[model samples]
Target: MMVAASEILKPTGQKPAALTIDGLSLEFPTYAGAIKALDDVTIEIGASEIVGLVGESGCGKSVTTMAATRLLPEGRYRVTAGSIRLFGRDPFAMDETELQDVRGKLVSTIFQEPMSALNPTIRIGRQLVGVIQRHEAVSEAEAERTARGILKDMLIAEPERIMRAYPFELSGGMRQRVLIAMAFSCNPGLIIADEPTTALDVTVQAVILRLILDRAKRTGTSVVFISHNIAVVSQLCDRLYVMYAGRIVESGPTRAVLEAPQHPYTQALLRCLPERVEPKAELEAIPGTVPNLLDPPPGCFYRPRCPEANDQCFAKPPSMAPAPDHIVACWRRETIQPSIKASEATQ
Candidate 1:
């Protein structure tokens, strides 16, 4: 039987959070204007816990992952507020050398496009060896041996052949496996997977998801999974954070939030899922586009599209409310339950 993320055992006397982003706000400067990409985003991932960041496209899910990994470009993007800590170390404050040390060894990322992340010119084995060698004071031969071992552990058939092959020679699923192998090469404490299964087919996606969950469980590694697919998040994550227009709209234990979503945006997203529709029934879509971050409207970022929006929603932004283990930033959460009930009844 596979262990759930919450079932993983933690080391004694360790801090509760392996990763924490407190009041994080980021902006990008373009000729158009400065676009606020993240606003007061606060989230935490405990040791061995899998936390999901879910939103529609352009909702800052990728930005949050980049910020946590310290991979955001320096001049193009700026952090106007908030702090991010990984394993109690401040990645933003670290010098280049120090940051380099922390990146692959302490933290690793599995990007959506494996072709872009992997070097096409280099042999897969050589790249994996380089990663291991960079983080450890080991001989080239030793690094190669370790690389092969990691690939084998990922359940790749003919691990030696895979190491010798270039990334272009591998299938999409195979290439993704290599990326997962590299991310786990150094036994990183925190792994950021930014839609790692997006390009895969359904069957392959299931395999990749299982590989990730299994590895994290075996190693007790914390994961920050970013996805636009709520189904994927619901399957893998212990907790969920819903983002819209750079702001977190709702967050709580995944089951709690999914079963009884408190914010209008979150509730609408769940209702839009394919499973919620009867056969031959038309799909539901959340009306309106995401707000323009450069010139976002006053008050709630989601107000313009919210079904339950009122005068108070246009007058001021809603603060997070104390709702047991859940947090919601909506003025009409109290009335949302009835709306959900009515929507369900219609279906």
Candidate 2:
């Protein structure tokens, strides 16, 4: 029986999403107890779309993406429920050999801290060329040529010099750009940028973001950009998901979420932004600390920190779409819906 690759990839008879994480719940087991890292996290990204995962530290943004890619250490964690799909294929079902073929070829990740990602001993050019050759069956000359072209696209000066230099020789910005170039080098369908610009200066961060956006647009690649800075994501992402503790409290188009966030946690996060406060006024901070994952609080994870929480918030809220394409999980959706409508009317 002969079967085309397209048919095998699209068994459902529809164009598959770039990435899908459906009702995923995960935990890390320790000697004392298991840590609930992600709970019912669901997200779907289409081809060429840029999605942002934003939250405070320890909010499971990194864990969710790492789980989707199966980069987490085996046996150290468990998926209690749910499924992950990359281009309609289950990552957890694949063996190491299959994962190796899928990782760089189908999906790639641009991690934080470029210095840690790159090898200190190898010249930048050779490293880039090696990655290009790994997933692609190209000659050394061709790989080197592609590496140089991608470096040029990153707007690096003296591509030849950069290729010859070691990882330690490049500045922080240059090193991050090299990493971005490497991520796009394989031309994967999906790219997970896990806070790629968090280490750079503000100026360099803007440049790095612009380069990523432009490259992804040109290549038609879907991007999952993880960050703690809501403002940064607002500038780069088409859609936004706001995570609190281990659950997504709000998710919608970037403009809609920014204009009228429905969840109390989301509203508090936006209020804490410095730009939203008057000059010299103290910036508002979300009260209360993130609950310990080992034995998380009952019901809504954000209830403790949410000032507007009522008795009803003691129970977990189901995810609801108050407006088309905008989903939020919060107990106060009924009351908040009117405010969202009012904001829309005013616009």
Candidate 3:
């Protein structure tokens, strides 16, 4: 039986975040100069919440996840500021051996491309068994049996046959299922799914999303679900963080942000969704391109494209303004809400 996402809840009061990223700033050097990939980005995922990180390409969504996993390349990527804690422990401070133990065992990741993530040379069964044995003190036979059982749970038919087949032999959907099985096999406390369904068909995409949500709920695992599709994020996540130009422009409970977005960038994002358009009307697209990280705008990065931008936006960067459960980084957040409300009312 599949567990409902709503049923997965953290107990109230002082519970540490499963994953906490505080004032994280990362930069990469190039001939042009240093490019800030992330800038003072802060986010938190509770022990059992499925939080969605939504943004367009090059908004630093994937980079944030890589940083959380301690997978950022040395020398190429530098952490300029801030900290990342996984279940109360700083992953950055851990030694190589400790970091390895934290990965796969404490936190697992489902990459965007299953083909790239899985080894074509190794048989599927051996890969799954290897992950299980590495994290658990199980015999080879026991590990193989556990792998088969996990495949069965993922609704794969003939789990034994799949184990023997190489990654090249399976369909795209099957390969993704294998990766999901490997991720959940260790019962990791946190799972970072970085666009796990981007390559699959609509039907298969729905199935994969359900599997991830159900498995997370059943195991009480916190999930950071990253995606470019706002619709998909709205459907699956309890909370949402809207990223733009390497900064989180807005964030709040999924329903609140989706229903009445305050930031102009987030409002434009919603306007671009297909469902928001009338049958004959043209699809909306946000104007202007993502800012060049090598030389981003000094104040508000989205000021060039924001309809509500003004002199204040150009003079000083906007900080996160609290609004009930929502947090928006826009100087005009108060003034923008009424206009958005009127526009929504007209629609």
* Predicted structure with the largest TM-score when compared to the true one: 3
Q: Could you tell which candidate, 2 or 3, scores higher by TM-score?
A: 3
- Residues 1-347 of candidate 3 have per-residue lDDT tens digits of 22211223232325567888888999999889999999988888887889999999999999998998889886798899988889889988898899888899989999989999999999999999999998899999999999999999899999999999999999999999999999999999999999999999999999999999999999889899999998799889999899998998888888777778888998887777666557778977888888899999878999998888889999987877765457788888778862343246236
Give the per-residue lDDT of model 2 (tens digit) for 1-347: 22221222222324468988888999999998999999988887778889899999999999999998999999999999989999999999999999998888888899999999999999999999989999999999999999999999999979999999999999999999999999899899999999999999999999999999998999888999999998899899998888988888777788878777788777777667666556798987887799999998877888888766788877755554444346677776667542333243233
Those runs of model 2 whose alpha carbons end farther than 4 Å from true positions after fitting are 1-14, 323-325, 337-347
What does candidate 1's lDDT look like per residue over 118-169, in tens digits? 9999999999999999999999999988998888887897999999899999
TM-score of each model, paired residue for residue: 0.92, 0.92, 0.93
When summed lDDT is taken over every stretch of 10 residues in candidate 2, the lowest stretch is 2-11
Error of 1 at 26 (Å): 1.1
Off by over 4 Å in 3: 1-14, 338-347
TM-score of 1: 0.92
- Ranking by TM-score, best first? 3, 1, 2
Q: List the residue pairs that clash in candidate 2.
A: none
